[model samples]
Target: MSTGTERSPAVVGKLSTLDRFLPVWIGVAMVVGLLLGRTIPGVNDALSAVSVDGISLPIAIGLLVMMYPVLAKVRYDRLDSVTGDKRLLAASLALNWVLGPALMFTLAWLLLPDLPEYRTGLIIVGLARCIAMVVIWNDLACGDREAAAVLVAVNSVFQVVMFSVLGWFYLSVLPGWLGLEQTTIEASPWLIAKSVVIFLGVPLVAGFASRYFGERAKGRQWYEEKFVPGISPWALYGLLFTIVVLFALQGDRITSQPLDVVRIALPLLVYFAVMWGGGYALGAAIGLGYERTTTLAFTAAGNNFELAIAVSIATYGATSGQALAGVVGPLIEVPVLVGLVYVSLALRSRFAATPPKSIVHHD
Candidate 1:
């Protein structure tokens, strides 16, 4: 029997409301971004600042603030219970690194060949997975929060290594069967490393350190009650705003090429459906519980656009189709994942009826 404390009504209610309304809020923000982008042509560049340290300080700040609360909830020790669950980890890795990319590549080839601009966009978007938003979605789905946290940490580490190598190889080395030109794709190892450090690594360290010291100085209960909940929604809102500003910056380009939205949306929709279904099946085959299965499914299906966007800009310039495709990813992903969270909750009853598996521990 589980001894974990049930969530408080207030926390549950707030989460529920956020889950219900977040999509609408994001939609509104996206529209607002388009309008703002149209009205303020130079606003995106204006909001962006370059530092002597060779970084975009404003974007980095937005990413840090957006990522902090999500990472703060992660507890790395939770992976011990299933250290030997190589099947689960293997499934996730294959889906994220291998199958996901293949699907994206296939979809881009099939659906976006005539649209070379959108083709590159789809490639960049599909190559990434959600690092921050998945945490919020997992929590809302009543997932094993600890497990979700561990996966976030794992994915973060893996992306720093894989994104540069794979992105370069994908753009430069892959055969022209997919229409990807070497000149169109550019990868900068240094810039990608900087973006990961600024956007993910720094925030993770800061969030963890803050949580650790706060728990010690106050107490675990106080930290969870007073801090976590307070910060969670705000972090989400921050992310939404940052995305809005990004879209606003691209508003004129998007407005000019309206069909690009449909082109970007189609592959993303296909990617989400295929990955979500595959993730759920793999998790079930591994006998993970409902919460774990749902967590893995959504995490697998979602794309980490923050890193994708950063990489796209660094590699292909801010105005490149690849960068635009990265931006379009969240527009589709956020709403779709929110809907899937509810779907997972509805399926919880079916999963709960199965016999429980032994809780295996690993270090």
Candidate 2:
């Protein structure tokens, strides 16, 4: 018999109707993008040509719009409270940075040795840890929202520094060790750095500035209640637009061999399941409460596909197999993670009977 912790009403964030039908929206976007790409001649070429030093200018702007609102919600002031639970922090970090990448590398090599571009793409997806969507998932699971927010903030900062170095190493160096001589990406760490700065840096700065100034001027409640909510929807709009643009550019490739998406999705599904299960077990072993356990699990399972897609297109051209793989990441991830939400709810009853911990202390 399994004991369970009671669910707290405060822990759940009521998802909007749009949030509930997110999968349908994304799927429609994919189809519409494909239609535009096929029917409107020169559409893809026009979008692709709007580039600066190999980075697509339009996509960069779209990504910045997509990422900024999420970053703005991060309460940098609350970061100090995270230290009270160092074990959970350490475990979550290990799963995200260390084990996550290694597992991706192993799976990519094992499943896609013959398909190197797809393999590189999968590795890229694994490296870009969750920032935005995990919050929704954490909320739905009744997880520790403050901890999730802190981890998201930390990951955002960490990604800008680490993505380039790791991208170069995993995509350029590690493939050769496995005796895959032909699998080489000429992409430089500088390119990844440049993309991260363009997509992530600008928004990160904007988000911090907005939060810092707005909070001081209008009071915390106004900033939190009004300012944050006002900008949040923009992120989703940007995401949908980015998806359309991605599919518009890659329509030909996708239409030719649609099975390629399925191929890419295989490893991703395994990665999500493994990461969620591992993070949950680790949290349990460390004696974390139900809310914290769900936070760690959802965070571990989620991928920042926005960053992944942008980096893929920037590193390899939009039409490349790698870019298609990146697109597939979100297409599969959204629905899968949605299903995991219910799983988390169901499994809530199986957790040890510890009283749920309140949110961390902060200003």
lDDT of each: 0.69, 0.73
Off by over 4 Å in 2: 1-16, 128-182, 290-292, 304-320, 345-363
TM-score for every candidate vs. truth? 0.83, 0.76
| Candidate 2, residue 242: how far the Cα is off, in Å | 2.9
- What is the overall TM-score of model 1 with all chains considered together? 0.83
| Clashing pairs in model 2, backbone N/Cα/C closer than 3 A | none
Clash totals, every prediction: 5, 0
Candidate 1: minimum summed lDDT over ten consecutive residues — where?
A: 354-363
Give residue 103's lDDT in candidate 1 (0 to 100): 87
Cα lDDT of candidate 2 equals 0.73
Q: List model 1 lDDT by residue over 256-334, tens digit each.
A: 8768877888888988989998998888878787767877898799887866777677666778887788777877887
Q: How far is candidate 1 from the true structure (C-alpha RMSD, Å)?
A: 4.5
Residue 238 Cα positional deviation in candidate 2, in Å, after optimal superposition: 3.1
lDDT by residue (tens digit), candidate 2, 1-363: 011234344332344555556667768887888887888899989998998886667777777777777667767676566657898789888999888888988898788878888988898888888876676567546676567866776676667677766766777677666666434444445655565566556776887899899998999899877887777677667767876886787676667777887788889899889999999899888988677888899989888776677777766876777878887787677668868876887787777664434342211
